[model samples]
Target: MSWRTPADALRNELIELFLNHPTESLSGETISEHFHISRTAIWKHLEHLESLGFVFDAAPRRGYRLLSTPDILFEPLLQPHLSTHSLGRSVLYRPVIDSTNRWAMELAEHGAPHGTVASAKEQSAGKGRRGRMWASPEGGLWMTLVLTKPIPLSRAGELTLLAGVAAAQSLRTLTGLDIRIKWPNDLLLNGRKLCGILAEIRAEAETVHTAVLGIGLNLTVAREDVPALLQETMISLSPSTSSPWTKARVAGAILSALEPLYDSLCQDAAGFSGVRSEWIALCAHMQRTITVRLGEQVVTGTCVDIDERGTLTIEVEGKRVQVPSGEIVRTEVW
Candidate 1:
């Protein structure tokens, strides 16, 4: 559910004020006067802030001071960092949800505007490619961007590839890591999975009505928080960087990166050729031998190229094969 109540709005504004002046305190009288509300109402908002993991120290004459904030992504804390024209104009931040993609789909079905974003601190039913369960614990970034503008259904796969570029660029800028794109929608850092992007489109016949782009980024999840089976394969971004990472900042960076790409895709379907070329350059398994699982059949071949329409081209048994959709199960250098 979205924050719609008057009290919730007031609490968000109060948090924004405290974020602007983290070290300084704001008097109850000042807050009440600013919002044109009573001191009792101001106290109520402060109490709600504490419930959402905000700690404030109150004094008799000094006022209330923000001591600390939770690691979760709060909209007030995230908005100031975003400079995008569209992507995150309307954000729905839920502390926990079943899945950001599912929530975004529901919102789009109900006529949510383009560039609406849904984010969660934790997802109980996060999903990956091929219906695999994505381990989404706390301290990770789980977000979905909804695009309501109409585009061709044929370009849906290219949209996924575009999202990969946006995510890779954002990660590279923030962590200074050698980030690589893995095939259609995964991002890797130093040969380990760092982020995954899933683009789901709702279309009619040949026209696309809406597309939901979901991104699951492994930020600061603890080793114990991840499933034991994925420990060897999946990795987080925290261990590779010297500085700490904030979900809000990383999320803003991704949305900022996606705005222009999404605009390009909406303008023309052929615009994806640039995105496809960039994906090929950043792909980790490009020109390497890999196994792709396509439904019941698995194809083992050398990764050759990704076409303008986002199909993976592979050379199998001296023959060129185009795979429109599949999962790269394994990759071998030689």
Candidate 2:
């Protein structure tokens, strides 16, 4: 069994105490007595929490009060709420990283166990499909799930679709938002991009050795902080609804929703069929005209259906053409 450090356990307890009384100040003596720790230890623990971005207000006689909670994916705050079997069994959290996907890939290559998760507060070099740079500022969900189980290489595409489904379902359950999956690996809210999924796999011949599924979700990004080029195309989740959401809460929900789907995909082929059906039902572009860009070629057609292998089938020139992968340039609704 994995054990938490004494300091970490104390920190969590302190956080819970603060959370239980967000508006009230708790005296140092009270906190120390409650936890059965020395006043100096409480001070040290508070300092450590401050270092993790938690804000506290202190006065000579008024004791200490939590000013604000950090917008970080702290494991202590997330683990209690997480209801997943394996997806987030071993989480590696970093304050900042070049890319969670890159880090997860390195760990997988070095024998990281399956269901390990790598998450970061911010990613300096996040990437999307077609080698496009993804803006991963603070207050967004940037994480990667490492899958070590061996499966057919052809099933890799389906796994990517499954990640999209998990994210969409999780958001819908949390906020009651109208979330929809866009083709292979994107979740859209009211026709705007809310989340992006990228799946990378390493395979020999037809067998897969490992796969890393990376997801970037915009939870609380400010409108001004968004890049000017993507202001209209991209959106954050907080602005659309009045419901308050924390980064750790949303992250836990995503993991909880993904765990069962991951188990089904690895254990039963029939389970993948159900995933595909749900994906199709949640797809935003079905029967809609879309332009897909493949290298130098662009095909404009009406999206008819997605096949068993998760290939998009679009009707072009009275014929249905299956597009294994491509960039969707535009979607036109009838």
Candidate 3:
């Protein structure tokens, strides 16, 4: 069965006609004559297009011309650019929400399939690794992508690193800034945090049921709202140095860039490795010393390499050991 009704398809075609027509306006009579439909049908299609958030300019000389398009995550804006499947198939858009990730979790529980995306203008209770409160105001892109691939639970950590590369590359493309990935999933400008990714997963027996990938970047937020403790954790493309971009466009670019990377992941494990090397080259603390806060075990060591599994290989006590999980820190945690 077709996903659209005849009227829906007709309405979409009418909007495209005005948008793509060489002339400024095609009169209702002209469209009716061209499509062999009645003038009233043409007018009805225009009305339907208007309800879908399109700007139509009607003039005496020119019957109708498309003026502006909706900036929301509507299909008109995204479907033209989206090329990946399943990863971003469904989108839940909102002007405001408590948290995109929270809502995505609920949706996943109720059988939302892989590649479902929940996006919001702002998040009231956003968070990061270690349950740290995340402040997601209106200026940044807040999204949580859901997936249920059949990968080992132990391999789950790698996806966060994958998300970091996607976020960093998207920012670079949008602002022309040299963004870097910090250890794990922090996007860094110079040495401060510009964006973060939080990966949540739920497994059943030997299979995975849900994976939520949450991303938040400070696109436009008051510097004072950043907690004093997070002063070092918050960074943005300074107005003088960065080109201004709308939050909606930023969100669009993120999904656009993520689609291919996700496809590569599904094709082969080497795809994840290739992206990991690029991440290491762009990481802020690749060869430097940092502390890994693993519960009460605070060990300060030189950061060596992050394996494909996303574990940090640290040189501590003259022995090379891999720290599987911890809150990576640039300073001594002890």
Candidate 4:
């Protein structure tokens, strides 16, 4: 809902009252006197809330009781649960957009502050690494976080890796699933792709002024809804777990998990060593044999370590090779 007018603000206030007393019935006269609006205005506001997927039970003497709220990623629904000082404190939400990354970049160009979050319910042109299109359906979390810090361009790769680690850690803790981070920018659940991270930065003179970290997580997408090519590889979260994780909850958890790590890296780039250790512990390819395709070269080796710079180390034919950037074509245990 566009909160540009006083009526919208009053409507939000009314919803908050119902949310605060979910089990108890609130009389319309009480709400009307509380908000200084007429009982007729209360009915009108409830209708507007109903259109937004809020279920209210109204009776003769007993007023209105909220039964359920929509799981959409609206600012009102998400703002109450956020505990971070920076990230997600100011949220801009859209029902449909071309890409959250694009929107975030635009905001950054206009001097949006650090830790501002832009999210969309559906993305028409969601981005993936290497200029690929990410399928951002309705039942997924598509958001971008804007970082307006002066991070050196050389160490920009750490953001994506740390983001993967944050997602894996938060999802595992929230859902009780074994979420693993594939080196570089992928999250895997049960050996299948569950989420992807794409980080874009605007840099000049070897320093980045603005970087947008875009994360796409499939939460409740169905199998058939997935593209045919990705059907065998991609997976969603809700179907695999018994917990009822709303999009707001997942989004809040990820931002909360990432804020401290991001702040540490921003304060001291050398602190990446500690974050690197955390990442390696969660790395899905560590100590496993994998084949990575770097342009024209395909290197198959056993993954050994990931350095502070977010480069992968592989043991190939008794020699250690550093893979600065590449895609893992295949993975095998032992």
CA lDDT, every model vs. true structure: 0.84, 0.83, 0.73, 0.85
Candidate 4's residue-wise lDDT over 179-269, tens digit each?
Answer: 8988789999888889999999999998888899999999988878878999888899978997778988899999998888787777764
Specify the poorest-scoring 10-residue window by lDDT in model 1: 1-10
Model 2 misplacement above 4 A: 1-48, 55-69
TM agreement with the true structure for every prediction: 0.92, 0.83, 0.77, 0.85
- Tens digit of lDDT per residue, candidate 1, span 1-334? 4324466567768888888888887898888888999999788778877877889999988899999887666768778669887787777777889999999998887767788888898999998887888889997899998898888777777888888888898889888888998887888877778888988889999878888999999898776888898887777898789888787788889888878887887877455687777778788999999999999999999999988888899999999999999999899841
lDDT, candidate 2, 40-104, per-residue tens: 98999999888879999998777899998876766556776689767776666678899999999
Across 130-213, the per-residue lDDT of candidate 3 in tens digits comes to: 888888776667888877665556567777887888778877877888888877778878667788898888887855557888
Ranking by lDDT: 4, 1, 2, 3
CA displacement after TM-score superposition, residue 228 of candidate 2 (Å):
1.5
> Which ranges of candidate 1 are over 4 A from the true structure?
1-8, 21-24, 36-38
Which residue pairs in candidate 1 collide? none
| C-alpha RMSD in Å of predicted model 4 compared with the true structure | 3.4
Query: Candidate 3 at residue 85, lDDT?
Result: 63
Report the lDDT of model 3 for residue 196: 87
Of candidates 4 and 1, the better by lDDT? 4
Residue 66 of candidate 3: its Cα lDDT?
A: 85
TM-score-better candidate, 3 vs 4: 4
Quick one: best lDDT, which candidate?
A: 4
Residue pairs with clashing backbones, model 4: none
Top-scoring candidate (TM-score) = 1
